[model samples]
Target: WRRKNENNNDDPDPIPCIALALALLYYFRLPTNEDNVQRNDRSTPSREEFGDVLSKYIPGFVEIIQNELEQFVNTDHFVIPHG
Candidate 1:
């Protein structure tokens, strides 16, 4: 099936990377005495949360995802943006 084409075998993927990064950033982003809401109930992040991560922790990471999605719209990679 599709399993044969993968680059790495039995490897952890982006889930843990993104999750741990967010958790660490979240822990540091809290106010000195404030508590974060329980994360168990919030499986999916809100758009604002994604924007917050992009703005505070990792900029252009989101834009990288955007370009990935845009690839589906235009497969011709040679297109010039300004021309």
Candidate 2:
């Protein structure tokens, strides 16, 4: 499904859509102050805790990144045209 972007009148890109989906997942996982209050665990998640949670959700994320990197390297001429 594609939605028109209000700013450019173009269909939304998949990259940003994926990023937004991941952001939503992280936002829910990392609870807010109100959520902490309800759970009665005031201490926030540590760096390791955050990494563990992210790793759980995105097991294939690293593979995806590696594949993209490989594709980029295989390209003969990697260049972005200036607008």
Candidate 3:
């Protein structure tokens, strides 16, 4: 993929996008409130709010993401081949 991108003068890679997505998911899963104080700043949306926004853009986003993750984990991509 890198070679192809380099040959075409395209951007380096899409790994950052995947990393950002995973980071966002992890952030949302954290509790919004801790010890009666907001865990995040006012600008940051809560998990429910983020989910609502995602659902508006992609209907059934949660289910779709969950299904895709499950599929990936069960596929050979997640496996380390024996030597």
Candidate 4:
């Protein structure tokens, strides 16, 4: 089964999509401006907003990340030692 993007674009390989999601996650975690960001000045409410966003999306995305990690380990591409 295949899922279509909201704009009706079909992507058979979703790996890039997941990679972009991870990049977005990092972008959101970054301070408002540290040279990479267009917006400058980190404020209290901006930090709060970032937290709110993480709380909203992290749970769902975490599962997706976990599945990818499992695939890596199963394929021997990842060798994470047990603690």
User: Best lDDT goes to which candidate?
Assistant: 2
Give residue 33's error in model 2 in angstroms.
1.1
Worst 10 residues of 1 by lDDT: 27-36
Candidate 4 local distance difference test against the native: 0.49
By the lDDT metric, which is better: model 1 or model 4?
4
TM-scores across all candidates?
A: 0.28, 0.34, 0.39, 0.32
Of the two candidates 1 and 2, the one with more favorable TM-score, higher being better, is 2
lDDT of 4 by residue, 5-57 (tens): 54557645564355447635663455533433445554533433444565465
How should the candidates be ordered by TM-score, best one leading? 3, 2, 4, 1
lDDT of 2 by residue, 15-80 (tens): 434534554476346765666677888588633455456556665443433444565545464765
TM-score attained by model 1: 0.28
Q: What clash pairs does model 3 have? A: none
Clash count (model 2, backbone only): 0
Q: Which stretches in model 4 have alpha-carbon errors above 4 Å?
A: 1-16, 19-59, 78-83
After superposition, the stretches of candidate 2 with alpha carbons farther than 4 Å from their true spots are: 11-16, 46-83
Overall lDDT per candidate, in order of appearance: 0.47, 0.53, 0.52, 0.49
For every candidate structure, what is the RMSD over all alpha carbons to the true structure, in angstroms? 12.5, 12.5, 9.1, 9.3
Residues forming the 10-long window of minimal summed lDDT in candidate 3: 1-10
Model 3, CA-based lDDT: 0.52
Cα lDDT of model 2 overall?
A: 0.53
Model 1 per-residue lDDT tens digits across residues 1-83: 01221477665456334534554576235432212234443444454455566655555554544544465347475655665
Better of 2 and 4 by lDDT: 2
